[model samples]
Target: MKIKEAILGFMREQAYKPMDMQELSKIFDINKEEYKTFKKAIKSMEKEGVIVRNRNDKFGLPERMGLVSGKLQVHSRGYGFLIPDEEERQDVFIPSSFMNGAMNGDKVIAKVLKEDVKGKKCEGEIIRIIDRANKTILGVYEDSKNFGFVVAEDKRIQYDIFIPRQKKGDAKTGDMVIVEITQWPEKKRNPEGEIVDILGKKGEKGIDILAIIKKFALPEEFPDKVEKFAANIEEEISKGEYKRRVDLRDVRMVTIDGEDAKDLDDAVSIERLPNGKYKLGVHIADVTHYVRENNPLDKEALKRATSVYLIDRVIPMLPRKLSNGICSLNPKVDRLTLSCIMTIDGSGKVVDHEIVESVIKTSERMTYTDVTKILRDNDEELIKKYDYLVDDFKAMEELFEILNHKRLQRGAIDFNFEESKIILDELGKPVDIKPYERAVANRIIEEFMLVANETVAEHMFWTKTPFVYRIHEEPNEEKLHHFREFIYNLGYVMKWSNEVHPRALQDILEKVKGKKEETVVSTLLLRSMMQAKYAPQCVGHFGLAARYYCHFTSPIRRYPDLQIHRIIKEFINGGLTEERIKNLTSIVEYSSRQSSEMERIAQEAEREVDDLKKAEYMSERIGEEYEGIISSVTSFGMFVELPNTIEGLVHISDLNGDYFIYDERHLALIGERTKMMYRLGDSVKIKVTKVDIDNREIYFRLTEEDHEDEELEIHDDIKESLKSGIYEEKVMAIETGYHDEVE
Candidate 1:
C-alpha cells in the first residue's frame, strides 16, 4: 500500500489512538531521510479528510474522532444530510444553522452532534470545509436596489446569490445567467457572485435546457480536434483486416431500437442448433476500433462518459461522425463488432460461448413499436410486412422467456416503475406527456443484453484480466429492516434482521404487481437498495441477482462499454502483455470512476429536464380535473400521481371541507369531524391549481368529495402556512436526495 493508504488503514484500527506525525513515522519505520516524505503523506491525508487533526495536531480517522466526512446534500429548505464517505455509516442530518458556510455538494467534515443505535438518523454540524463543488451558479436574475438576486435553478441550493449591480454585465431582470461566486455564504447572508454569462431571457425556446447543460458542466459541443479525428476515421476495412476477423456477414441479424433512435449500437441474431440448443449472438458496435486508446475522439468520449438524452436534444458522447455515421450498426452496411455467441440449453444456461471480433451486415433495422405489434398484438399485417425476419423474431421471444424465467428463479428483484415521455412541440414547448411502457419487444432486448453482459463479465473474470464491472453491492441492513417493517404495517409478513435474500423482496413485488400501491412499494424498495455503478471489483449485483455483470453493449453511448471493448479486443488479438496489463490497471480504475461519476451527472440532467417539461405541460392545464392515486402522505399533504406518471402535491390546506389530521402509521390523512380518510393508494380526483416552472413544482386541490357536503371550513393554521410556502418546502424536503432511476 501507498503511504497515504497505509496511514488511513492504520488509523482505522479499532484500538488505534490519535498519534502525532513522529509517532506514526515510528510505527511505519521511517528513517531520517524518509521523514519529510512520510510527513507530506500525512498532510495530504488530512487535506483529503481521510484523517482528522485534533487541536494537538494528532491524526486519527474522522469517525473515531466523532466526525463525519462526506458530501453535503442540502435540501431546498436549507437543511441538509451528510452522505458519509465511510461505507456502513448512516447519513447524518445537518440543520441549516449547523451548516456554517458550506454550500451544497461541498465536501466537509462535520462534528457529530448526536450518535445513536444503528437505524436512527444521526445529527451533525459542519465544522470544516474540505472542498468546494460550486464555483459558479446558474439561475434567474432578479434586479434589486443596489444588487441583483439570482435564484438558483436547482432547488437543493436554497440560497439566492447576491449579485453586485456593476457586475451584472448585459443582464437584466428575468434573464437567465451563470454567475461566478465571489464570496461564499456566511450565517444568513447569501453567497455573493458576479454575472459571467447572460444566456438569454428566462422563457426562451432553448434557454431552459441550455441552463441545465451548463449546470452539469456538460460539453456544449465537441472540440475541433476531436471532431476532425472522428471525421477522418476510415469507414472501410482492408481485405487483410477482414481476413483476420471472424466474418459473420452471412448472419441474418437485426437491430432493434426506439423509433427515433439515431445511434444503433447493438444487434441480435439467434438460431436453433440440431441438438435442440440455441445459439445466440449479441453483436455490439466496435466503437474502440475508430476511437483508439488515447486518441482525441477517445479522450473526448471518456470525458463525456455517457450520452445525455434530454427530451429536446441529445448530447452524444462521441461526435456524430462516429456515433451516427460510420460506427452505427446501420442496416445493409458492413460494420465491425465484438460478438458474444453463446450456446444455450433449453433452461437458458450458457453451455458454451465465444467472444470474438467480427464483421456483419444487418439484415434489417427494426423498431420496438412494430415488433411489439407483431408479437404482442398479433397484427397480421405487420407480421407479413416483416416476413423475412419473422422467424428470428419468434426465436428471440422463445429465448426471452427462457432467460426471463431463469432470472426470476434466481431471485432477481425487478422494479417496474412507469416512466413518462414528455412530448415537445416544434418550438420545444411541452405538447403532452404519456406513459412509456415496457412491451414484449423491449423486454426481449433487455434480456438479451443482460445475458450478454453477464457472459462477457464472467469471461473476463476467469481470464484474470484488468476489467471494469457493473456492480450493485448489497443493500444496507438498516434500510432492509426498515423496508420490512414498512411493508408489514401494510399487512405483509417478512423477517428481517442481518440479511434478507433478493428472493424475499422479489416475492413481495410479485404479490403487489397489479395493485394500486405497486408504484409506491416498488419505488420505496428501490430506494432501500444500493445504487448500481461501474467498479473494478466483481462484487456481484444485488438487483440483478447476478454473480457477474458488465456493460458489453451500446459502446457508442456508454464509455465503460467502449473502454472494455478495447481491453477485450486486446485479449482476443493476443496483445495483453504483462506490461500492458500493468498500464491498463490504472486506466481501468480511472475509466471506472469517471464513467460512474459522469453517468450520475447525465441521469440528474435528464431527470431535471423531464421534471421541468412535465411542470410546463401541467402549467397549460390548470383547473383540469384528473384521476390520480395518493402516492405518499406527509405533514403538508398527500402527493397524487396521475396515470401518465406526473406527480403533484395536494397540500393539506386544499383538503377544503373538514379539518384533517395526519396518521403516520397508515400514511393517511383523516378528517376529524366527518371521519373521512384518504390513505396511500386511494383514488382521488384533483384539479391542477398552480405551477412553479422555475422550481418544477406542481400543486393540486382535491375535487368535490363527500366532505364537501358537510359544513365547509378551512383550517386557518393550514391556510396561514400555505401563504408562507411552508407546504411546498416541507414536501420538497421529504423528496430531497431521493432522486430517479432504478438501473
Candidate 2:
C-alpha cells in the first residue's frame, strides 16, 4: 500500500471523530490495500516529525505555516523565486508551474510543502496572492483590418489584451495607450481590455512622456478637484495665526535655489553667538498647515508619495498653488514654517536643538549662480544689493565648510560625477549637453539640509515616534566581492573582505578620485552599494554617515516630508501614544512603498525623455562616424556609447569581419581568426548604422579599417579562464538556461 492509502486507513481507525475515509481517500487517492500501507506510513511520518497523527489519525498543517512569506521574484521565463521577505532566510524555489501568474514585487503567502532537501534547498508554492503590485499597464494599440490587440510594452507580461475594433475608439495602429485590464481569461493567453485613455502618436514628444508616466503608472497632473481646492487656499497669513506660532519675521533668513525654481520649500538663517557657538535655523514650508490628514488634497499627496522630476519639467506631489504659491518660502513673504533651530559648536556638533512652528519673512531670494558668483569672486555689487545677507552668507559659508570637514571625518562617502544637463533650443530640441557643475552655494544648502534631516530623524527616533525614515541598508557581501573583482580587472585593487565596513569602500573611492578609470570605478562602487529607501525602521544612513536621517527639508516636493511634519506635530501635541504610534507605523510602511514606486516611475520617465532626445538627435546623423567606448558586452553583441553620451549597439553579425565569441570573465568579445578583442571600457570608433526611435533603440557598426589597440590588462586567473574556454562555457551556461534550472 502507498503512504496516502495507509494514512487514510489509520485516520479512519484511530481518529476520535473519525475522518471520512472517502474524503481522505479522494484527497490522497488510494485503494483498500494502499490504505493499509499508508496506515503503516503514518509511523514514519510521526518519527520524521512532519505531522502528529492524532488520536483520530487526522492531521493539520503546522501553525507556523501562517508566517511563511517572501518577495515574489518573477523570472523572465514566467517562473520565479521565493526570496524570504524577512531578509534572513535563504531564498526558496517556486517552479514556473506553481507561479499562478504572480509577478515581481508582489507580496505572497507561501506554504512549506517539504523541509530542506539534504539541508541545502527549500521548496514551496505560492498558496495565496496576498497583494498584486501592478495595476496599470502601458502598451501599443495593434489594430489590424478587423481585429485589435494591445501589445504590452513590458516584455515580462506574456499576455496581450484582445481589443474590439469598436472599442478601440481613436487609438490607431501603433498608437500608445494606457489599457486597464478588465478581465483575465482563465484558459486563454490574452486578457480583455479597453482603451482607458489615448496617449498620442507613438514617438511623439507628448506621447513619449505619457508612455513613461504610464510605464510607472505615475500621475502627470493634479486632478481638477485637487487643483480647485489648492486655488481656493487663503493666500495671506492672518495675525491670529501668526500669534499662535513662534515669531521670526525679523530674522534675516533667505531662500536659495536653482534660477528657475518656483516651489521654494525651505529657507535658512545662520548667526554667531557671543558664546562662540553658531545658531542655525532651518525653516521649511509647513505643508501640513494647509493640508490635513485624510483630506482630499492630503490623500492625493499621500498617493503620489514623492514628486517626479524630469529634465524639462516636474510632476509635483502637490498642486502648483500649494507647492509654488502659499506654501512656498518665497522672498519677502511671511510664510508659516516648521523650524529646527540648532546651537552648534565649531566642531559641527549640535549643542542644543529646538523645534518650533514659526512665521518667517525671507530677507532675500537668490539663485545658485548668483550666490556662487558672490562667494567665489566676492562680487561686491551683487553682495551689496542684498545687504542683510552679507553677514549671514559669511556665516553660512563657515558652517558649511565645518560640516563638510566633519562629514569626511565621520566616514561619509562622497560619490561625485558629471551629470548631463541638456540645453534645448526654442523648438525643444537638444542643442548642447553640458556637465552640471556643483557650486559653493549648492554645498552650503546641502550641508544645512543634511543636518536638519539628521536632527529631525534623531529626535523622532529618540521619542520612539513612528515616522518614515530614509534608510540605506548595508550592501550584500557577495555582490561587493564581485564589484571588487570587476574593479581589479580595471587595474585597481580594493582591500575588501566580506566583513569590511562601508568606510573601507569610502577610502577606496578617495584613492581613485582622479584616475583615468575613476568614472568606471565609481559606477561599479555604486552598483555594489545598496539603494536608499524609506522605512519605518531606523537604520543609520550609510552614505551620509548619519546616526539618523529623514526627508524633512523638501515638503514642497516630497510627500514624506509633509507626513513627517504631521507625525512630529502629533507627537508634540501628546497625541502620539503607543497605540497611535502603532497605527502610524503601518502608514509609514505603505508610504515607503508608494514613494519607491513613484521614484521608479519618475526614473523611467526621465530615461524615456533622454532616449527620445538621443533618438531625435541621432535620427539626422545616421551613418555618421563617432568615437565611442565599448560600454557593455553580451553574447549577441556589444553596446558602444559615444562621447556625446548616446549609446548604440554593435550587433554580433556586424562583427562578421571576424568570427567572435563572448569572453565572459574578461568582459570582451573575442575573434576566433584575428584574436581581435573588444572589452568593456575599451575606447573604439564606430558609425551609426541605424536609428529606431519607435523602438527606442540605436544600432552601431565598428569600422572595418579602424583598429586602435589598448589592451585592458586583467588578472591572470581571468585571463587563463578566458584562454581555456572555461569563461565562454560559463557564460553560455548562464545565457542558455543552465543557471535557471539550478535556481
Candidate 3:
C-alpha cells in the first residue's frame, strides 16, 4: 500500500487519536536512518490534504477533519469557490473573509465549515495555498505621486497591484502593462509587483487585442530560429516524395472556406459510386510533412496548440510561410495531404474507408456565400459560375443530409447559436455588427470533417496506438438537475432519469424552436454540457455522440492534428517499434494536456477581444433604443441581449418601478409591491445607458417609450379589425386556439 494510504488507515483504526512524528515512525517500523524519509512522506500527505497536522504537531486524516483540496476560482466580488479535483465532489463556497490570502486560480486546501447535504451548498475556509496559478498579471498601469498601481483587466483578480516607482520600468500612466508579483498580499495590503512589459496605451489601435493576448500569455511572434527554419523548408514537392504518396492530383476537389480565408487547409471531393453509394474524400493539408517532430517550427506549433482567431486578426499556429503558402491547399497548386476517403451507403453508414498520405491539386476555391447561393437559394448565376462542379456539389449536399440525419438519430445535440460578426474599418474601429450566419454550405463541410475525424480516430484506436482524442464527459448531475428545474419552470418538460442523455436536451430545444426563448434556452443548455477537450484516453464525446473522435484535419491550425499526422505516418511507414511506442506514450500524454490548456487560453483571449470590439461598437450608439430579450437575471440586475448579439446589463437601480427582489428559482426580478416580474426570455426595450471601454462593459436602462409604441400599434390593429367587423370573429378564433397558431 502507498504510504499515504497506510497512514490514513492507521489513523482511522486509532478511532480519532492523533499521532505525532515519533509515534508514526514507531508504528510504521521506521528506524533513525528512515526518520527523515518518513517525515517527508507525512509532509507531502499533509500538503495534499490526505493528512493534516494539528496545533499539537500530530497528524490525522483530512476526511475525519472535514477538509478538501481543490482549485480556487475567485469571483470579481471577492468571494471564491473551491472546485475539487475529484469529479464527483461538490464545490465549496469560500467567503472573502475566509480566503486567507488565497488568490484566484490558486490550488488550496480548505477546511469545510459546512458540509453539503441534501442540496445545501458546501462552505469552506482556505487553510493553505498549495500553488499559485500565475506569477504575473496583465493590467492598465496608473501613475501616483511616488508609487503607482495596476488595475487588473481580469476582473476576477479583484486587487490592484501596487508598483513602487522604482519598479515601474518604462510604463507610463494608462499603459497596458504586465506586472510580475514580487510580494504577495498580507493583512489588508495590496500585492506588490514590478512592471515587466508595457504593451501600449489603452486606446491605441490593436492595443486592446494585444492586452488580451498578453493576459492569456499567448505567443505573439515566432522565435528567430523557428522562423528561419520554416523559411528554409522546401516549398515544392520533390519527384521522390511524389512517388511515395498516393497520387490524387487528377481528383476534382475544391477548397470551401470564408471569402477572406487565407489558410486553405482542407478540401473536399465527392462522387457517386457504381453501387449508388457516395465516395467522399476529405483532404487535409499535410503540415507534418514539412514540419518534422522536435524541430524549431514543430516546437512553436506545439506551444501554440491551436490558432487563435480574434475579431480582427488571427494568431496562427504555424507561420505564414507554411500555413498560407506550401502547406495551404490552394487551388491550382500541388499540395500534399493526409486524406480520409470513405464510401458511405444510402443510410449514411461508412461501409469502407482509407486513410492515406496523398498528393492533390485543388481545382477551385469556393466560398460559403457562393455555395449557399448555388445550393440553398438556387441562384442561376452562381450555378452557372461553378457549372463544372455542379454535380459534385449536389452529391456532397446529398451525403451531408444523410450523415446529418444519422447523427441526429444517434442523439447528437446541435446548438445552433448565432455568433457575432464585428466589422472593423482601416482605423481598427468597429463599423458594424451582425449575426454570422451558418448556411447549408458551412454545415456540409462541418459534417464531412466530423466523419473524417471520427474515422481516423477509430482506426488509430483499434490499432492500439497512443493518440490524442477529443473528449467531452457527461455533465455533472447537480448542474443538470438545476438545468432541468429551470427548463421545467419555463414550461418545458425534459424527461430525467438516473442518467441524462443528449437526446433529452435535444427534445427540449426542438420544442423551443422559433420561440422568443430559443436562444437563451440553447445557451443555458450549452452551459450545462461539459467542455470538450483533448485527452489521451478515449472518453466519448457527449456533444458529438461519437464513441471515438480525434482532430485529424487542419494540421496547419491545430497541433493535435499535426501530432496525429506524424503518428499516422509512422504507422504507415512501418509499425510502431517498442521504443517509438514508449516514447509516444509520454509525448502524447504531455501534448494532450498542453494542447488543452493552450486551446483554453486561446478561446479566452478570443472572447476578450470580441467583447472589447463589441463594447467599442456599442459605444457609438449610446442612448439608442434596441429591442432585446432578457438573457439572464441576477441579484444586481438582468442582462439584455439585442438582436445583433450585443448584451448589456440593466441594473436593478434603473428598474424605476418598485423595490425588486431576485427570484433565483424562477430566474427573474420580482417587484415587491407591484408584483411585476422581468424574467428570462421576456422581450424588453432598452436604451444604451453607459459604456465602460476600459472594462469592456455596457449598461442599459429599461425604456418605456418602445413598450408604449408597441401597445399603441396593437391597439390600432384591434381598432382596424373592429372597424372591419372582424373583432368578434377574432375573439372566437382565439377561443378555438387560432391565437396559438399565430403566435
Candidate 4:
C-alpha cells in the first residue's frame, strides 16, 4: 500500500493514539535509507489536509481532533455550512465571524464547536483551507482609476476580485469578464485577480446566459475528436446487425414529446394481449451501440452526464448529429433500440417482461399539445386529422390512469408544485413566465416511462448484476420530527408508526391540493425529503414508493441510461464473465458518482438562468402593482409569489406599519405592537421596487396586506388524514398502504 493509505488506515484504529514522526516511522518499520521519502509523503499529506501535525510534535487524522473536512457552501448572508466528505455525517454550520476568509465552494477543514441541539445541522468554524474551487471568478467588471474589481454574479462569494490596472486587459466598466485569481484572500482583504476574457457588456443580448455558462463551468461544445467520431458513424443500420436484433417495425409505436423537442429518446407501443393483459413496449434509442465504451464520443458523453435543458438553449450531453439524428427515435424512420416490453395486468402489475435489442420504425411523432387536444378537449379537427390514432390515444389514457392509481395506492408521494416556464422573445429577453401545465397526455408518457424503468431495474437487480440505480433514501429523523411539528401547528397530522413513510407525506399533500397553503406545505414537505441520486445499489425510491427504479428511458440525453443499456445488453447476450464483472463494478461505481455530481451542476445552472431571466422580466415592470401570496417567511423578509409563479422578496424594512419579528415555529412574521401576522398563504399586494439582474434578485415593496388567513376551509381528505394511524398494536397491526409491498 502507499504510505498515505497506510497512514490513514493506521490512524483509523480505535485504540491508536497520536504519535510523533519517530514513533510512526518505527511502527511502519521505516529504515534510515527510506526515511527521507517517508517524511516527504507525510508532509505532503499534512499540507493537503489528509492528516494533521499537532503542536505537540504528534501526527493524526484531523477528525480525531474534532475537525471535519468538507466543501464549504456559503450563503449570500455570509454564513456557511461544511458538507462533510464522509458519509452519514451531518453538515457543520459556520457562523460568518468564524469564516476565516473561506469563500464559497472552498474545500476546508472545520473545527466542530457545537453539536446541534434543536436543529438538523451542527455548528463549526473553518480552521484550515485545503483547496479553493474558484480559481477564476466570472462577473461584471467594475472600473476604477488605477485598479478595477470584478463583482461576482454569485452572491455567496462576498468578496470582489481586485484587479490591477495593467491586468484589466480590454475589459471596461459593466462588461462581463472572467478574472483569474492572482492572490488568495487574507484577513480583511479581497483576492486579487487579472481579467482574462471579456464576454460582453452586461444586459447585452445573450451576455447574461454566457456569463452564467462560465459561472457554472458547463461544457459548451464537444471536442472535435468526439464530433468527428460521431459524424463518422453510419446512420443507417447494417443488414447483418438487423438480422440479429428483434424486428419490431410493425409494433405501431409512436414518439410523444414536446413540440420543440428535437431529441426524442423513447417511444411507446401498447396492445391488448389475449391473456387479458396489456402489453406495453418502451423502446429507448440504442445510444450505447454507436458510442462504444471508452471511445472519444462515449468519454465526452460520460463527462456531460445529462442534457441540460435551459429556457432558451439546450446543452446536450451528445452532439446534435447523434442525439438528434441517428439516436433520436424520429417518426417514420427505422431506429435501433433497447426495448423493455412488459405484460401489465388490469391492476397495473407487470406479470411478464422481455428486454432485448430491437429495430423499430415509429409510426408517428405526437406532440403533447396535439395529443392533449385530441384526448382531453375532443378537438374535432385534431381528432379527425389523426383519425386512425384516436383509439390508441384513448387506450393510452386508460392505461395511464390504471398505472397512476396503482402508484398512488402504493403510497407514492407526488408533489404538485407549479413549475415556471419562462417565455423569451426573439432577442432572448423574457416575455413572460407561466406555469407549465401537465395534462393527461403528459402523464401517459410519464407513467409508461416509470413502469419501464422499474421493470428494467428489477430484472437487472434480480440477476445480481452491476448497474446504476436511481435511489431515494428516507428522510433524516431530525428533519422529519421538525416537519411533523410544523404540520401539527397547521392542523395536519403525519401518520406513521416506527418510521415515516411516503404515504404519510402524500396524505398531507392530497389534503391541501387547492388550498391557499398548498405551495408552502408542499415546499416544506419536499424539503424534508432526501434528494434522490444515482447509486450502485438498489435501496428503493422513497418518493415513487418504488422497490426497484433506475433511469433507463433517455439514453440519448442521460449517461446513466446509456450506461445501464450496455450492462443490460451484456447480461442478455451472455452471463458476465468474472473479469468483465470486476471491470464493470469499478466502472459503475465511478460513473454513478460523476453522473450525480454533473446532474446537480446542471440543475443549479438551469435554476440560475431561470432566476436571471425572471429578474430581467421584472426589471421591465419595476413600478407595476400585482396581487400575490406569501410563499415563504424568513427572518429578514417574506417571499411573495405572483400568479405567474414569479417570486419576489419583501424585505422587512419595507413593511409600512410596524416592525415584524419572525416566528420560527409558526413560520410567520408578527408585527410587534400592531399584532398583525404575515404568515405563509396570506394574500397581499406589492409593487416592484428594484431589480438586480446580476444577482438575480427582485425587491418588492408591500402596498397592501391581508391579516386574515386565506386557508379557511378544510377539505375532507385532511379530515380523513387526521385519523389515519390505526397501528395501535404494532408494525403488522397498521392497515395502511405505507407498508404495502410492491410487485
Tell me the tens digit of each residue's lDDT in model 3 across 56-128.
9987865666778877888766777887866577778887889888888888889999886775568889988
Q: Please, what are the lDDT tens digits per residue for candidate 4 over residues 391-466? A: 8888888889899999998899988777898899999999989999988898899999999999999999999989
Ranking by TM-score: 1, 4, 3, 2
**Per-candidate RMSD vs. true structure?**
5.3, 8.7, 7.7, 6.9
Of 3 and 4, the candidate ahead on TM-score is 4
lDDT of 1 by residue, 529-629 (tens): 88899988899998999999999998999999998999999998876889998999999999998999899989989999999999999999999999999
Candidate achieving higher lDDT, 1 or 2: 1
- Model 3 scores a TM of 0.87
Off by over 4 Å in 4: 1-8, 19-59, 118-121, 704-743
TM-score of each: 0.91, 0.81, 0.87, 0.91
Which digits, one per residue and each the tens of the lDDT, describe model 2 over residues 206-264?
56656766777778778888888888888888888888899999988889999889999
Stretches > 4 Å off in candidate 2: 1-84, 89-136, 185-188, 274-276, 377-381, 387-391, 425-428, 496-498, 573-575, 628-638, 642-645, 656-677, 703-730, 733-743
Candidate 3 accuracy as lDDT:
0.85
Question: Which candidate gets the maximum TM-score versus the true structure?
Answer: 1
**Cα error of candidate 4 at position 478, Å:** 2.7
In terms of lDDT, the poorest run of 10 residues in model 2 is 733-742
